[model samples]
Target: MAEHNLGDSHQVFDGEGKTFTINDKHVAIFNINGDLFAFEDACKHMGGSLGKGKLEGNLVACPNHGWQYDVTNGKCVTENECESGCRVDTFPVKTENNEIILSLPE
Candidate 1:
């Protein structure tokens, strides 16, 4: 596992998300109720940018096609169901001294 420091935690406010490009990987980091969750930024159905999606609780709706994903676990919740083979990759996230840290599989 490789870790990358993503600057201050305050950069991502509660109920919001931000995208970062680390090691050539596009990742979206979300702050939900002061907790952080990281995952791939691309939507599975149409390659929409999840970082720019609309957040509703733990789920984010894709701005392009309305596909929804649970930011907490990277599960596709479109149509109130977890579609098989329609999940995004998730990463480990942490915060230290106001700095957001993310882990990526190597």
Candidate 2:
């Protein structure tokens, strides 16, 4: 278990950008404009790392099976074979001193 600090939330744009030390458990953090959001980086359909996927608007499309998820809400849009309750765990992000702090429970 480890803690990492990502700089100001406003530095990222709407694409496959990464935050410092924000990669773990196949999860990754991304910023849309100045809003921060985190998602299970692995795609539910094929275990694809979404951090390397393409970001279309607020949605991140899985590179493996083309499964798309709404980065803002983690909503699957590919209509894959995942169970209705299947969903990625969303992280709670806070900003302080112009920096984005992600709190993960160990």
Candidate 3:
């Protein structure tokens, strides 16, 4: 596993999400009620950017087709119309020294 430092945690507001490209992967980071969650930026349904989607509580709605996913576990909350398992890849995230760190597969 590799740890990528995503900037200060303060940069991400509560109920909002951010995107970062690390090692050629688009990672989405979310701040939900002061906690952090990280996952693949692409939606499982149609490759929509989850970071650009709307966040409601722990759920994020894909901007392309309204597919909702839980930022906490990357599980699809809405209908699973995706033939290819409707779950986004989730990453381990933590806050250390005020910085958001994401652990990605090496």
Over 1-106, each residue of candidate 1 has an lDDT whose tens digit, in order, gives 9988989899999999999999889999999999999999999887899999999999999899899999988989887554686789999999999999899998
**Clash pairs, model 3 backbone:** none
> For model 1, what is the error of residue 83's alpha carbon versus the real structure, in angstroms, after optimal superposition?
3.4
Off by over 4 Å in 3: 83-85
How would you encode candidate 2's per-residue C-alpha lDDT over 40-93 as one tens digit per residue? 677888777777778878888777877778888787877646667666777777
User: Model 3, 11-31: lDDT tens per residue?
Assistant: 988888889999799998999
**lDDT score at residue 62, model 1, on the 0-100 scale:** 88
Ranking by TM-score: 1, 3, 2
Q: Which ten residues in a row have the lowest lDDT in candidate 2?
A: 17-26
- Give the winner by TM-score: 1
- 99: Cα error in model 2, Å: 2.1
lDDT of 2 at 30: 76
lDDT of each: 0.92, 0.71, 0.89
Q: State in Å the error of residue 80, model 3.
A: 5.3
Candidate 2 wrongly placed segments (more than 4 Å): 1-4, 8-11, 19-24
